[model samples]
Target: MAKVQVTSADKTKINTYTFFLVSRMDAGKKYYVVSELEHLTLEADSSKVSRDGQFVGKLVPESGYELPQNITIEYGSDVQKVSGNLYSSVTGEINLKASWHMLIRAKGVKASDFFVADHVKYQITSSENVAVVGTDVEDNATWTVTDCIIPATVSKDGKNYQVTELGEEAFIGCKKLKSITLPAGLTTIGERCFAGCVSTLTEMHCLNPVPAAFPQLFFHDTMEELNNSSPVYDCVLYVPAGSKAQYAQAEGWKNFGGILEDGEIIEPVVGETTDSTMTITCNAFEQATGYIVKVYEDAAKTRLKDEYQFDADGKLRSSSFSFTIKGLSAGQTYYIETMAVREGYYPTPIIISQNTIEAKTTGTATANEGVTADKPIVCVQDGEVVVRSSGEISVRIYDLSGQSIVAGKVTGYGSFQLTKGMYIVVAGDESYKVVIR
Candidate 1:
């Protein structure tokens, strides 16, 4: 393995450190193919935390080279090797390397103007010197392919250009799309790109270990809506070995079936996550306008537990930040899932998994009908379940399965003593799963 040096950013002080890469384009390779290195991991000092939860403050080339804005550096915020995108690690070590942009003509191309080359359809995005791929009603009828490989460069009009953006709805409803080979330069995948092929896509061979973003949505409108049906990409997403973690955290990259790196399976690819929080980090963290974090219940996701959203105001953390989820349902597990976000919004996906973080403070109360209560609501404290409301109200205790374990009625205030354990208490419309010791 070769070594590279970059500076680090600490929370309250200025310090310099080194980082390394996690994956390469080919096996036994010492140098990186710039295209394949786009999302390569940049390892950080394990004993390091960013001055702003990131290490890219002064992270420039050790001697010369430039760290372009498009380039990303990912590192594990912890020893687990779960890398944060765009040098967005809070711990551990990972590096993200991006190369030059493919230019405008590489953005999107229409299928109606398709050009055929090597049994694959192609279209030039124009005189910008590159070929692009895009779709509107994707005339898959003209070219029916069950398995497809998009070459790094396609020939058109006696000229060759690199393949970049995979246009919006590239294969919106292509049921026969069993597998696809995306080139290393694919940066943008338009909305609803894979609208209805969640089941048929068995394998995805992505030459790029990491790119700018990925936005794969099915028939559902939003991620939460999709969560109500399918929580992850059923197909296995294959990428370069050692780059699984970066792919996992890239926008809309988490798939329940698995994100495969060099044939090995890594289930539920996600960013850094803890019991009660999911963190979103990236080299482009500074460029993000803002972010939205929504959490859903493990079962019947329609029931939204709570949400946290923030804009990229000056108050935001510099490197990476974590969302502390609240309102735990008794016996209920919350998955810190993300909505299918667009590429321009943010760079990566949150570590989607079970939320184990607990909240001790009380939150706004909701009645059985979801009506807000301004006064006291419900909370678990002093080995008991406390319910308070300004008007007539009731409380019910349910287990993880939604089966009512106990019930209580109260008009003003009531406290039900409890044993040592956890319970889901619903006061009015608001519900909270809490622990009492």
Candidate 2:
């Protein structure tokens, strides 16, 4: 057996004021010193949080070129050693050194402190990045965060940090979150950050006009409608001025149906028009609200001609309503406005200008001269004629001209291929005008 000798250096005895052995891990016998370092520990929620600083061995004063001997600690069968003096500091002290400390936080340690706003938890990192950590269950609702701590950074218990990203599942299962105003400086949103928040989340106000890089499933399992490309149903993404086009082209960001700029609410779209009727579609914030569609004869939209309201009981969030205004003059320009009404609040109204098609009556023609007026109902589906009445019925399809092209009999449901054009379909005494495209 060989005996071992141990020697230690104390900087305090030399009146060096304060000595710090910056610790670093190395594989060889060479030791290094560092000034400052950071370490993260995995939390129970699977998030990473920084740990408090630790103390390293004391630093020894520089002697001749002959390097000082290494120090080793022995405990039963385990042995550990730390190195110092990497690159010398300008002050003649070894600021960078090798550390034997495990760096990783041990179990039973409390998590880091975080700020709370509108029931949501946010942790600020040393790099000035914000990370959404968690939220309080009892205070779930549509939260609007106007601004975060001023100066972008805050100090708590002598620790300084800033906000930058979102942790995984930050808003998961927050079903009552009707909307959220994201703070600026957010660069990344972890996977599933908004998962399970689909039920009531209808609006997202992103202060960061530039689209941030989002990971897979960022909106996964949310209430929004999902398509092959993305899951952006019923929600609106509001960005800064002149940023609509940028967001519209970014992946995930483009999926939002309504990507409007701040202060720009999308007006209702006019869909499907006829000589006497026109359909107007509008989006709403929540279900159970009342919707009103008003038509005006003048461009000012002050003179109301007709008013249409959806059955209040039929209102639903994450859906659109199409209202048709009938008894209107053909080939006439009209001004339209849509309003969403709730019990306690009055939402902004949207206005648009529309025109009705010119009115025309079909010329009288006799295809089945004896056919009665009560003919089977007919419709077009997938470029084919579908007879939606019981029993076989005589079917005659004619082009825009009185010329009869196909004369046949279809029972129950039937399909037929016709050129992409307007045609008059006659079943018994009934006639239907359909377009195939």
Candidate 3:
């Protein structure tokens, strides 16, 4: 039979505290045994074992002896033994498993120990270290810190600082920012950073070339700055003298057109004039080819003035045509409107005159001397009347019931033929009874 010993060692005493039979078996055959023991130690070097108490090693039996057959090992309260034949010429080995428990401790300082001030301008370095200056910040104002990277370089002039990035919203909404000096190394601007800043930032100095994606909202120097859609014109854009063409092609910056140079002012288009003579002069008016000018008393009236064509120079010579408004009664008001016309093309018409000049008679006359009515009851028809007048004069007719019969206006010597009726004839404020048959 073969016998195995189990022991528990205490490091404090440097000696074994418990001992028991670990396993037993008959020589030359295999056997199985199960046992449970705590705090067991092997004769091998203990330091090689893990802190979890697991053991990995071969257990060798005496030389020239075979391991027991049918052998099984387990752990519990007592050591166990099983029998089986073992060969004397064979050697055998065994292994055990166990575990150990341990505790861990933390090292060094906490994050909260490092503090940063609130509500102040900070110049963050490439390493992300932040330094606060003060808290008196201007509302909606942006400030840029140049040469942000540590170990920054200086220009030959030694007067300017270079930076690689425009900090987020560095100059956004600075309603009072009249000017800004940008570093040459700047490559990109952040978003929504400069909106609502139209009132401020009259000028921006780009010491370096502007980045390709320079923000569109940034109103840099250009003519569009002065001609912006806003009804209020307040500022002028000034760009590098020779950069007008390049900036004009830039996307958002193009809104300010190119920078204005000396003697490059463009005059505005003048509107057409409206006067009693029905004459108009628009400086921008082009000499419309095959175009005609039309004048009308009113849209509802089919009557139209003669059409007149413009000369090659677009000048409508006063003698080219004259509008004589006939069928107009003295002391009567009339409206006149004029329009430019071309076949297949209709531009806005120029209102030569609206609600203009009164038509007045040239001569005066006496009353009743030229009035006659053959019949008493005046029948209204197509607004005409008949009356016998002595000498050149004007005539108006009214029915017997005192209602105006003929609203037609007339002047000069004439025998007025009207529908049969008795009517009151009125000539320039003088009334006379007459009959038309």
Among these predicted structures, which one has the highest lDDT?
A: 2
Q: What does candidate 2's lDDT look like per residue over 1-437, in tens digits?
A: 11111122332221111222223431122221222111211111101111112222332233222111223332235554322222111112221122332221111112344566545565654554546666644333343432222233445566655656776556655666666777567777766667655444667888887888855566564334233323544466678767778888998887654566664332354445555666665555342246666778876667778887654465435455566667766555666666554332113322111122111111222111111123444555456766644467888889888899789887655678887777788877777676564
Global lDDT scores for all candidate models = 0.47, 0.48, 0.33
Judging by TM-score against the true structure, name the best candidate: 2
Residue 202's lDDT within candidate 3 is 40
Which digits, one per residue and each the tens of the lDDT, describe model 3 over residues 209-292?
342465533432223542454422122333443554565566655443123321111111111112223222221112122224
Worst 10 residues of 3 by lDDT: 99-108
- Candidate 1: regions farther than 4 A off: 1-114, 118-120, 126-143, 216-227, 263-437
In order of appearance, the predictions have TM-scores of 0.33, 0.37, 0.24
Q: Worst 10-residue stretch by lDDT in candidate 2? A: 41-50
Global Cα lDDT for candidate 3: 0.33
Per-residue alpha-carbon lDDT of candidate 1 for residues 12-92, written as tens digits (9 for 90 to 100): 222234333334532332222111122122334444432222232223222222222133222222112111232211121
Cα displacement (Å) at residue 337, model 1? 34
Better model by lDDT: candidate 2 vs candidate 3: 2
Order by lDDT, highest first: 2, 1, 3
